[model samples]
Target: MKPDTTAPLTFGMLVFDEVEVLDLGGPFEVFSTAGRLARTAADEPLLRVLTVAPTVRTVRARGGLTIVADHTLDEDPPFDVLVIPGGVTTAVERDEKVVDWLARRRRTSALTFSICTGAFLLAATGALDNRPATTHWEDQEELARRWPDVRLCTDVRWVDDGDIVTSAGISAGIDASLHVVARLFGEQLARRTARQMEYLWTDTRA
Candidate 1:
């Protein structure tokens, strides 16, 4: 199997059982299609996206859709960007292995992102300590109590706190990914990519 090597932008999206599909897939589409979107009378898609899961077998998402993992965490390469997807299971409050991986990768990645409840995983790594952040609205209360060091915002779609980024809910993940593309490439490119994905890109967070 060959990778979609059109844009040269490499992404690693962490997948596990019950991952919120859109949180991961949204960015994958935005980033992977960037090369095609950026194709300005000359360029095609230069982006390469790999779906990394805990296991190589197809893992079911929260919605019962089975997805084939392109790479396992063990085979994960050094991604230019790392995306952390959220699910209701993420709210269970403890998943040590994932927490550990985020802790390790956040230090090396160019960007670390979280969607909805996935911010809990980032917070577990102490990356957001004393930093401004926003997670799913429902978790704002407990998140504040559990991690008092983090300034949790209940009103934003996402928060870009330097090296780390956090999004509010499921669809907010879409907004976060577009913002990432804009920062890396340009607003024009991001808008182009969003249009291709049929995303409206209405982020009021900034």
Candidate 2:
């Protein structure tokens, strides 16, 4: 489905048990704050940010951070941008239902991206097949071993392959989110938002 570019981009970050807190929280901060900072004269935000979980409840994240999902998988609104964050993801990676949902999203969402080991879950849907992608440096070999069809790379902050983007672990998600903002809005707006977060945005690719 072709997206209406004029509409506010709705970003949904998928969260599961043991998800990396920084992976989800970092991008959430970037997109939500950037949307506020990038509002127009109409006062409509440029982006809408929310969390999606298998269920509508709090999930324990890595480092014991508890996060309540804004929407459940079946009740979420249409997502223009879907973010998959990574941590201890064996459960999500092996879930057939979740993989099917991701496959469907890949066909419809304007953009579908992943951070760190979340690439494993995305890869299970075959979305990353024969496409360049990156994950956390530590899991680079294992990801390649499991998803041989995917062109996995390392030493990169993120890989922006048009509709799909994958980034390195944790903090790298922030850079990738800013990159998305820059692509959709403008560099000036992304820079300003990064400044507000006191984060130095890096666009370097490997």
Candidate 3:
């Protein structure tokens, strides 16, 4: 793995048991591919992507896909962007250490994003306390009921509130990642990244 200094931005994707693979993997592919393409173009890589967990162990995703974390909380590198992916929210949300770690990381991270029910974890950190956020539509009611202070936007594919971004569900994460690329790099680069993935880029919300 490349050191954090090799890339302009470092993205940390949080993972745990039952995490939605696509939620983290989609963005991972986007950012990593974007970086690779940028290097090919004789430009510096835009971002470095890696997965981090509470421990350096394998986690069984919701669908039974086992994934080994790239780093543990204690040894993970600093990240400019922190991506909290949704899946099996109860376990992660209830973990105070994880929430606290997120709170601490937010202070130095340039951007933080949540995909699907991952918003639950982000919200648990009090970062989204009074801000507008969106999550998987299926959990919107529960999220609203639990965190009344957060304004829930259920009608959009994703919500971008400056430094914090949240996407509706699985596939939407890819779109949100492209938007991040556009914001950090440029529109042309974002388009190119999407095209390389053969993904349709729709600037529906952002």
State each model's CA lDDT, in order. Answer: 0.76, 0.86, 0.85
Compared with the true structure, what per-residue lDDT tens digits does model 3 show for residues 12-123?
Answer: 9899999998997898899999887775333677677888888656888888999998888888577788999998889878888888888888777888989999999988
- Cand. 1 Cα-lDDT: 0.76
Q: Pick by TM-score: which candidate is best?
A: 2
Where does candidate 2 have its weakest 10-residue lDDT segment? 1-10
Better of 1 and 2 by lDDT: 2
Q: Give me the displacement of residue 92 in model 3, in angstroms.
A: 1.2
lDDT of 2 by residue, 1-206 (tens): 33244567788789999999898888889999988887655567878788878765689999998888887778856878888999999988777777888788778888898999989999999899999999999999999999999998888999999999999999999898888888877888889999999998886664
Clashing pairs in 2: none
| Candidate that scores best on lDDT | 2
Model 1: CA > 4 A from native: 1-7, 39-44, 90-93
Tell me the TM-score of each prediction against the true structure: 0.86, 0.94, 0.92
Worst 10 residues of 3 by lDDT: 1-10
Of the candidates numbered 2 and 3, which has the greater TM-score value?
Answer: 2
Q: Which stretches of candidate 2 lie over 4 Å from their true place?
A: 1-6
Pairwise lDDT winner, candidates 2 and 3: 2
Clashing pairs in 1: 6-45, 6-46, 6-47, 7-45, 7-46, 7-47, 8-46, 35-45, 36-45
